[model samples]
Target: MSTVPIASSRSQWLPAYLALVVATSVATGVASWMFLPRPELGPLLLLCLMGILSFQIREPDVGLRISFSFLSIILLASAAIVGAFGAWLVGSVSMLIDRRQRRWTATMFNAAMSGFVGAAGAMVYAMLGGVEGSGTVGLSTVALARDLGWPLFAADVVACLLNAALLSGVIHFDQGIPFGVQVRRVLSGSGVAFVGYGIIGLLFVILWYPAGLGAFSALLVLAPLLAARWAFIQYGEELRSHERTIDTLVTALGTKEPAAVDRSRRAAVLAEWIAEELGLTPGQIGTVRYAATLHEIGHLGVATRLLRRSPASLSPTERRVIDGHCVVGARMIEGIDFLEDARSGIRHQHERFDGTGRPDGRAGQDIPIAARIVAVTTAIDDVIREPGAAPVVSIAEVARRLRGDPGRFDPDVVAAAVIALDKHGWPAGSPAPVAS
Candidate 1:
């Protein structure tokens, strides 16, 4: 749970508006290419310019955004003569803004900031884009596009996507936990720039000066993007405001409810090794890590004492009720749009590959891939988390424990489990790593 504020630094709105400018340029470029005749290179050049601006927009605090705004105006005004230099100049301007100190993982920040400069550069490129590809408007777009090839294009697209992603990531990371943001807002807002450009190009069919119309259209897109930014801000704030309520709800469910589950610092440290052993991609690694923290969320519905009870002490009804948690947890998450992607893991995490598992009794291929991964991980975590285990146990002994009956778990899952145990120094009878 988070408590995003309603009035959090209204200044963030400035950056959001700048971001919109670049977004509109992208929207118009694509539109013009699709609807306009033969598609003169003007709008495309602007798109490229926006690409750089989108990356380079972040500058040294308050002073720079205003400064860049003016520079962008001059760059656009002088576009006919300066051409690509003007475009690159705007990108360089953003890059030049000093942030006082470099962050440990500043690469994405740098790339995204560069895009901001590119956004302004798009405006500069607007005049040149209108010069008509063959003559005065310029060949910078063609030359840059050819020179950079797919690598640059890929970078551009990634920059756009990452700019949105990184912004949300920064907010979440700074807030000190995992929480959801409205992904649709970021995507739609970023998309508007290109859309506005397209509409303007459409009007140019009868208007003649398509490039000029395209610039004005970019302004049109800016309006909506700004509103969207406000919405994003509001959404973030509302999330913050509701943090306490969500936390209380989690407490109502269980001592450590899955919905509000927070990873122990130690668990986070150990998770990295697990991720490496599994050869998980960055994205996959995040999923597994989050799954580990929320693995017990379904237990919210289970009787508290039942969780504490030994296997022998439980009544048949109590035990059955405990096993039904996966369904309960999954259903609870299904109601949330953001968590839908992880519902499969939350539900079938306790299931085995063979048809012997509880709840849905999904077998083998019927099981979701993430659920299978979680099942192995859940068992491994349990093993290490137990106290008074032997330290020098053989990997084969551990393998045998999990492999007691292949039908009880997926063969492949068991195999992966064995490797994970071995990777984490879990020799025969050794104690598993306990959650912090």
Candidate 2:
């Protein structure tokens, strides 16, 4: 098939995400004000939720970018906590310990130092502003526990959740997860989990509460919280698995299609096609999808001069760098567990049917099957992305290019590639496949 030129890329954003965060924060705060306490703190709760945006700050931690994601849950969950403890000060401390001090003890000492200082500061500010009542938590804090019959502890719990969200928002993190993905997975799974757990808790309340499971009623109520964590972890893994695959697909175009320059877009489309032709089971497909995207990430190490210039004009050093892309890519994904599946494929993509490939030079069946499949698709993608050169051609034509012998590709993998492209209505002619 003919290659499609890469489109001008659009910058991704978080508008919908911002709307969601604001909506949730306001909703939680409003509920707290209406049903519980602290109507004055609702607006403050909204401001604290805004802190979710802080994770986007670009900073390199060692070589890995900080994710800043796990704690977003901590923040959203903590909104009530901060609101209840509104007048209390917050703190932070970092210190180096002497030789005899245990590491954990030193860490706790620092945390305590920071926590106490922060608490003192908050109290001092409140005192200066003349917050007179010992029982009052904030300006509009509900005196419901006193005025009505609600337990103070329950009111404090709601306040604690709010406080956690606010503090989580403000606390700067060096690294974590993408807030968007985190939100998606958290929302997707937690929505389902909350409902499920709610039903279970309802049954427990209906059946057990009357039967005097009173000693454990509070513990039974904690089910939904536990469900939230379980749901988050499970769904987060699913989200991350796909994320790794998309990264893999991008890696492929970046490396093998270096000369084509339209690689990112082209490889993405081909990856979609290959995913179908390979007849991957849904779970396996997810892994394959991510692996294909990152199959050429090592190519990033190749010098721009060498990538663009004629091979004849390349210097020895540049050639070495160009050849070393696979190794680089493998190293890049070494830390990501789901991505480990794609590493062998990326590393071996350049390997030939005969054993002339660089790095390890494993030949034929010795090479991982995934690597072979990636190699064939990569070749086809490059041809399609070729600028001004039949960028509108058909899949049959591209398949022919791939089929020509001379140790070009593993023959079975080539067949698999051709079938995949054709069945998916692939190439520059068909609608391009989308990457995550």
Candidate 3:
């Protein structure tokens, strides 16, 4: 979950939500101090230091607001070695010393959430018959596994669920995103990483006690963890570079018509929604976005005067030149490796479903799915932007127009577009009311 504080200016429930989390954490810490056994100072200090370092060295997560780190491994191990109060201390202190400058609300929320996760995990570990600290010293590997394995694993699951729940709560209150959606996103995005953290946390415990490495076990684990962070940084950079390339192309397209940029972005969003409704793969959805954004790029190849003129004023020869922009846009990006699949969509976006329209005249299912999606989405955007047309009225009209024109659009794609629009509504400024 994201450590960044969502702006609370418009959200009435966010401040109240943050206060509840902070208060719950304080109560947990107080109870742990009152009831749990005191932890060994030396090992507790070592874990606290390691936890602070883990937070500082977080890895970037592409397409997500949350940062990733091996702090979970440290927290889980601390639950076993330091007892509940010590675990809470380690988590709280680590956040208090965080070097990143942030709003006080964010700092408080993160620290409290971390402490709560630690204390809860430690409590679960103790309840599940887990041995802590010197209790497992010199135990055989098999014996240690029998005593500590399931407890530590269970502790890890509790930590994962609690952390996701708390984070999802703040997001739901602050951004109005549904609670269930954020929870599912957390599981799908980082579920595997959490499982690996549990295993590594177990290994850290074994190294500290049975193998007699103690605090030095942290040093041995640091190497691979840092390497993984480096790899993710490179991946995030590559994704950013791809976005930069797409932006350059879109900016060039905007030079012909200033409104083209906004239209392209709106079309891309609608196309993505339609793609999701149709259950397309992630890669195919990405291709549809690219195709929608660059669908009008061929106009750059036409003369400025011809482009400025209305379609009704253009003679037969001029109209053909205007219509050929699709081919021109396709050729412009043919050498771009990442856009190879999108090229086909851009090349055929103007084609009619019945084979009566376009440079290639491909009909029905013969047309690429990405092209069909772009056709319907762009048409909707065009209709919505017409002078004096109400957004709600335009949406209904566009849905009817697409459904009624079987020869112009794929019937299946039109149906998906209509459903997606009704479910999610249109983008900001277009204010489409959801169908009841």
Q: Tell me the alpha-carbon RMSD of every candidate.
A: 12.3, 16.9, 4.5
1 or 3, greater by TM-score: 3
Name the regions of candidate 1 deviating beyond 4 angstroms. 1-83, 95-293, 315-317, 390-405, 411-436
Residues 19-61, model 2: lDDT tens digits: 3434443443344345433423543343233222222221112
All models: lDDT?
0.44, 0.43, 0.80
Ranking by lDDT: 3, 1, 2
TM-score of 1: 0.50
* Residue 418 shift from truth in candidate 2, angstroms: 2.1
TM-score of 2: 0.43
**Regarding lDDT, does 1 or 3 come out ahead?**
3
Best by lDDT: 3
lDDT of 1 at 318: 88
Query: Candidate 1, which ten residues in sequence have the lowest lDDT sum?
Result: 61-70
On lDDT, the stronger of 1 and 2 is: 1
Ranking by TM-score: 3, 1, 2
- Model 1 accuracy (lDDT, Cα): 0.44
C-alpha TM-score for every candidate: 0.50, 0.43, 0.76
